[model samples]
Target: MATVTTRTVEYPADGLTMIGHLALPAGVERRPAVLIGPEGLGLSDVERRRADALAELGYVALAFDIHGGRYLGDPQEMLARCMPLLADPDRMRGIGHAALDVLRAEPRADPGRIAAIGYGTGGAIALELGRDGVDLRAIGTVNAVTTGRPGEAARIRCPVWAGVGSEDPIMPPAQRDAFTAEMQAADVDWRLVVYGGALHAFHHPPVDHAVVSGVGHHPRHAQRAWRDIVDLLAECLPISG
Candidate 1:
């Protein structure tokens, strides 16, 4: 019972219409698409039930909306509109390249099987759309933080999987050990599971501190981070049926 599609894009930088949610997978044609990025108190209902559970797992899920429809239950006014657009790492990579170009221009979305997932501040806008090279074949983040920007981890060219919370006091452990030593000195193809005692928006759930800013939830690390984000989008988008 999940064949959703709701739109309202229009984000020409700051005009801000935003509000997408596209879920489709039933008789999949050119599926494999995901662009969800909400968790700065914007696209709620648990991010449309995690984009309808990633469209019941056949993929084609888009759930972006960087707060244009404006919902701020006032955690300091949603952290002053998402912490100054996440402190402007190139305007969060132009809002994750305008929501990955609206999920690669829909039409059942394949675009070489796109992928992007986010949670806290949309996992830092899915790690700035994999650091901004963005031909994304895979990228998933749950408790993201690092926007330090030193070469930006060699501009990730996809294949990243991060789900943190080793008691995430806003991503501690020396900034996850300097973002895992800058994604292992920019070798890229990263992976960072950590989850021991879980905290910061551990896949979001118990929120009502006047609309979330803390009140951690770790339902078994949010079901093992949604099966490690569908096994890292089926090993970087591979489901052609």
Candidate 2:
């Protein structure tokens, strides 16, 4: 097994000090990199572990922050902060860019071979990065099928993969259709997976805290979605094994 190392990263973005988690494979030379965006709440252990897993796969991975450095356990607080933030594409790009800068600055990151993945609001930010014309190998998101301005999406030069639960009220059929239509209209190479019987944030591990309606966890689907993400990375940004 390859050894991995992780560290806390503090950076500035949108007048806030963003705290990110950086994980790297045990090597000197640069390797393919992945930028992980966490759920709306913040950068938690889940995302940090995802980064570590990617690093173990021989890629430099950085789990970027969302709410500066705090997690919003309350559903209302999360929505209150995320809704307006989601509505602003520029802000999303700024946040993504900030994290990208941190990841790219790592000596072990191959700037040219990079991908971005996110959950929920973080996923939306990842999409925004692609729409902003960042040179990414691919983009993957879970429970975040947010669309951008048609003209802006046209600037995306990479494939996009999004996964959502079929029964997720937060991302219902209408939203899914709209997202797909936007992607199609932009002529982007995009794919969507609907996990049957899953709910919003189904990709996350079950938490003891109370969540809003339509939120649940599905271990099976979560694993499947993760596998899909890994496959996407292997296809687009494969590194020598």
Candidate 3:
């Protein structure tokens, strides 16, 4: 693995002091960057480590926050905050744009070669960014099959890839179908991967806190999803030496 450096970044978003984790690969040249959004529970070590891993693979990465500095371990609290936020496209775009601005402003990041990836609520935010006509090389989401405002998906200027567990009640077949329909109607280059026998948040590892029903980890599918994401990035935003 390449040497990786990390730091905490504080920025203003949604009237909160959002704290994010930035990871840079060992190099002086401006490199391709990726913005990673955390699940609705908020940013955690898992997302931070993901940023570090992306940096090791030679991409500057920022694991953006959702609920400012708070990690809501309580399921009710997470839903209470995220449900309404998800309903508002403008709010999601605001948060996403704030993080994108931070990543683009980083000295190590190449502003033109950035992608957005997220899980659950985070994934929804990434989609909102694309729908808002943000210039992104690629967009990837896991367990976040959210449809945007009417006809807004046509604004997505990059390839979109989404992954969902086949057994996930939160993102069932209907939701996945709706998301794909929107992508298709917009003529967006997109692909969806359904991991069989997995539940919601299957890409996420086992957590210590109590999670909502129909959410569990599938170690095999999780690894596969990661590889799929890496492939998407490689195809859309290749890293150069």
Candidate 4:
């Protein structure tokens, strides 16, 4: 495996300073980049490690920040801050675009070859960027498949892959239906995977510090979901090893 370099990055978004974790492959030559969005709380070590893993796979990856450098361990606080942002498409797009600019500015990143994958609130931001007409090769999300506004999804020019826990109360059957309906209505190349026994934030390892309702980690499904996401990227943005 190629050596991976990791660093902290700061950028401006929504009148606040956002901090992100960036990972780059060994060589400086331009490579495909991936924008990683963390869960609703913020960019934790989990997301940072994900970026590192992608870097080891020979891609530049940035785990974008969502909470202005603060990790919201409290569920209420997280919902308080993220719920409003998620409700406003313009705000979400702004946040996503800000991180995207940082990723594109990296010397090792191939600006023309990029993908977005995120979880929870971050996943919604990825979808927002795709809906905003960003030229992404692929978009993948877990536990966050918010339906875009009518006609907005038409702007997405890349394949979208979404995964959700079948029993996720936050993203219930109705929400999944709406999301799929929007993608279908827009005629997007998309796929959805429903993990049978998982719940919201199933990809997140159990946090000893916080416990949130309707959220649980499913080790087996999480591994499967990661494989599914890697498949999406491989199909859309080929990387030669």
Number of backbone collisions per candidate = 1, 0, 0, 0
Pitting candidate 1 against candidate 4, the one with the higher TM-score is: 4
Stretches off by above 4 angstroms in model 3 are: none
What overall lDDT goes with each candidate model?
A: 0.77, 0.93, 0.96, 0.93
Ten-residue region with minimum lDDT total, candidate 2 = 147-156
Question: Stretches of candidate 4 above 4 Å error?
Answer: none
Using TM-score as the measure, name the better of candidate 1 and candidate 2: 2
Q: Between candidates 1 and 4, which one is better according to lDDT?
A: 4
- Give all TM-scores, in the order shown: 0.32, 0.98, 0.99, 0.98
Candidate 3 residues 1-241, lDDT tens each? Answer: 6789999999999999999999999979999999999999999999999999999999999999989899999999999999999999999999999999999999999999999999999999999999999999999999999999999999999999999999999999999999999999999999999999999999888999999999999999999999999999999999973
Listed per candidate, the RMSD to the true structure in angstroms reads: 16.4, 1.0, 0.8, 1.1
The 10-residue segment with the lowest total lDDT in model 1: 5-14
Clashing pairs in 2: none
For model 1, how does the per-residue alpha-carbon lDDT over 135-156 read when each residue is reduced to its tens digit? Answer: 7888888888575478876878
Better of 1 and 2 by lDDT: 2
